[model samples]
Target: MPLTILQKAKKLFDQKKYSQVISLLEPNILQYRESFQFYLYLGLSCLHTGDAGGASSYFQRARQIKMRDPDLLTAQAALFLRRGETDQAVEYYLDALEYDPDHALAKKALQFIRKKGDKETFLNMAETGKITAFYPKPRRTSLHPAAVAAPLAVFILCASIFGIKAVSLSVGQETRADLSSISLQAIDLKNSVEAGGSYRYILTEKQVVQAFENSQRYFQSYRDNQAQVEINRILNSNASIAVRTKARLLMEYLSEPGFDTLKDNFSYATVIQDAYLYQDCWIRWKGMAANVSAPDDRFGFNFLVGYDTRSALEGIVPVSFDKPVFLDPSRPFELLAKIRIENGSLSLLGGGIYQSVSP
Candidate 1:
């Protein structure tokens, strides 16, 4: 009788023979086309063995089957961050947040990434229309021997060309109209306010200018750090080569930062609180901070000052402060908050500290 592969693999695994188990499972993982668990286990095995690249590949395979797992998403983001691919890390972090807005790890990862350096590369691409541009493809040109040999074929070919040309003209007109309509809709939507009143639909041109200004400051700081490192070489014999190398690597990485997708960031925020439920009652409410960043989209209530958590730390709630909403990419947004109970009676949470963005 043949010994079972799974039994042998298990025996190897139980004996702390990870290499043997991996060898046994590797064949099966390749042979079985539909086994997501195999890939998940393979990823774990690789991770245990310190093969980051192999682990990432296996985890990516697992992700194809379980696309929306926040835990896996966070793990992938961590891996990307370790590999010095912060842009990729931020992408996965955003993906993880999309699934679980309250995901603390993902939230922290995003905050950490944002603080590293401004993502100027991504923003510049957006500003230059590179990200959204559709390049014009040239039409193929050819002369067929059949066109000269057959009159009927030539007539048919000419008719087909005219038909295609007519269809192309019609499609071109429709496409232009569609593009124009979409552009107008985008402008309108950008001008609208979110349900949470926490964010405006469109970043004003002024906001874009401010973003560029901040990015320039970040770039200047990055370059200054580089210059200081170069100048210190003469007197810095005590500095380890590895430390200097690592610093140089970091500076290079920060030189070209990426940008968040402005379109995706403008979506309506989830509803966190219902005003009618706590009408005229001073109540302490708790929620995930990411959801509270822009609350105007979900409700029409005005922020009266004592409702904002502007001064609160990331991943922590400030039940005491009542401030208005503010959008700052350099900071972690306390998306979740609630009105505080003060004195005996309920008052409309009012504090002029926070102002809702314009629609």
Candidate 2:
């Protein structure tokens, strides 16, 4: 029944109550640390209040979190304009157009800049109310000046870094055989906009950054298991697909530790305490097989860990194997199996076994 901070902020911003917007959002910065919209709103308010330093700081923070936002770009352009940085303003507007060609503020700004971007003329225009036309309203999310970049533009952007074989051709001998021709290859520019405007807003951009950094640190420490947990956190999070894919790829060089070489060889008791922690970890457990069912290649049994010593039974864990092994219920064996936490139950997936009894 209550409006959230963002909803209240949006209402205040739309009403042109820029000071109130700043007042409402500044204190709650911690709550919305990862929120791009929050920073964007704050930046817009700061710019309007004539605090260029504050606006620049908020805008820079917003850009670090999400660079492709058109509204943020347009506001940044406005900030550059107020700071008397026409060149930078033009660049920001152009950058905004690249992401959103139909951006109204960017288009108007670019057009106005082209006509009156000169120092004295721009200053004269600023004296009048005409310059206000280029400023963007936070509520109005719209884009239209330059068309979306075609495959040709794509080739141009990539020309300096490396030659895209499919999109490049050598020109007539002009010293270094200047790459002149851009391939006519069609590149479908991805206009990715989420259909539903509502979002759950799970992990903040800051959290994602911290998690990724922690994972890299863990990886550098050679604690691949801990590193893997952090990596999986990012992979399984509600972060962007590109970010998740990047997280998945960051540990491509990670080497899985063997059961024998594992730094933390968790005991049955330790595993029993927290199965999820030891998940996927392989441990050599000593036990005897019970209810042995070996049919051809598949083997299934209940491993009675620590039952070898008739003094006490640690736990009975269900185990299964795809390899053929003539297991005897009467004889004791040491099982090296990977821990699996399935449906809140702990189980062992058999990898190998050392038999005390003859095979």
Candidate 3:
């Protein structure tokens, strides 16, 4: 019997005949439309032939068919790294780890790159020197007199200030009491702001300004959860509209991809807390579709989402899709979406929803 197209492709692929694999697979892709393995093999074949675009399309189709496939994620990450897209490569690698933390290849690749540092550093080292058994001696340099004196001056200044402040505080009971009162007041003000209190009524202008400054410091340090809490407090407090708007914008900026180091996959609560921050950023969220709306004239759809099927629809989030989405209320779904916050309401703008496989 003559070998089938898929069998021939597989045989050629295993024999390292990548071009032959492509020739066999390309024309027969439609015939194997439901075969993820076919697309995956074709993608790998294209990758070996240096046809990155073709490989990417094939890989993407495979991903759409099975989004959580760790092998596919790792393959895509490798492709991204080859293309010099380090950030995207890292993202995909991290995502693969999310699915399978023990994935040895992804783990090893991430470790190697992280230790090697950036590509430029690696290239520079490679171009500047050749490997040899014998190596040249290093040049030595002496520290400048100014560099030595600078640290001495700073040390003396800091010591003097510390001594003066310590003496002033030790001088009187009244001064100690006053300082304690002030410290307590400052703590109270901070707690009030973090708890979503109206700082205008309880704190002076200087205290309010200090609280805002402290919150900004938290934001800069990647403490986004704390920053969002403070921002929420400011929004609900009796702050000026200008201050509130600035707070909203700051919250939105902090929710961007590179801002938070701790979270790769943001929760729905995270999105709801600062929807504006996640705007234009991709998110992976899971929820059950409660009420799926018909597609509008623009082919957009809206749906109310519950965290799970058994949950009540009230207080549920409204998710808008710029394109129609096929939803089944019985099955829980996950979506990789771009967030949109309009008129203080959060919605998903446009992205495909992935239905969970039936158990």
Top of the candidates by TM-score: 3
The lDDT for every candidate, in the order shown, is: 0.38, 0.64, 0.54
lDDT of 3 by residue, 222-314 (tens): 555556556655554555555555566665445333211334455666667656545544566556665566544222334444455546542
For model 1, the run of ten residues with the poorest summed lDDT: 260-269
True-vs-predicted CA distance for residue 181, candidate 2, Å: 19
TM-score of each: 0.28, 0.41, 0.43
- Best candidate (score: lDDT): 2
* Model 2 residue 299 CA deviation in Å: 68
Q: Which digits, one per residue and each the tens of the lDDT, describe model 1 over residues 1-359?
A: 87666556646554657677678788885364345555555665555455656666666556555555665676666555544566666666655555555556666655545555245543453355442221111112211111112223322333342232212222111101111211223343343222232321233434433332332343334332223223223112222234323333333333211121011111011112322222222222222222234342222132222224454322222332222222322332222222332463322332212112221
The list of candidate 3 runs beyond 4 A from truth reads 97-102, 121-278, 281-336, 339-359
List, residue by residue over 273-292, the lDDT tens digit for candidate 2: 75665566567888788898
Q: What TM-score does structure 1 among the candidates reach?
A: 0.28
Q: After superposition, how far is residue 255 of candidate 1 from its true place, in Å?
A: 20
Q: Model 1 segments beyond 4 Å from truth?
A: 1-21, 30-32, 114-359
Clashing pairs in 2: 102-143, 102-144, 103-143, 103-144
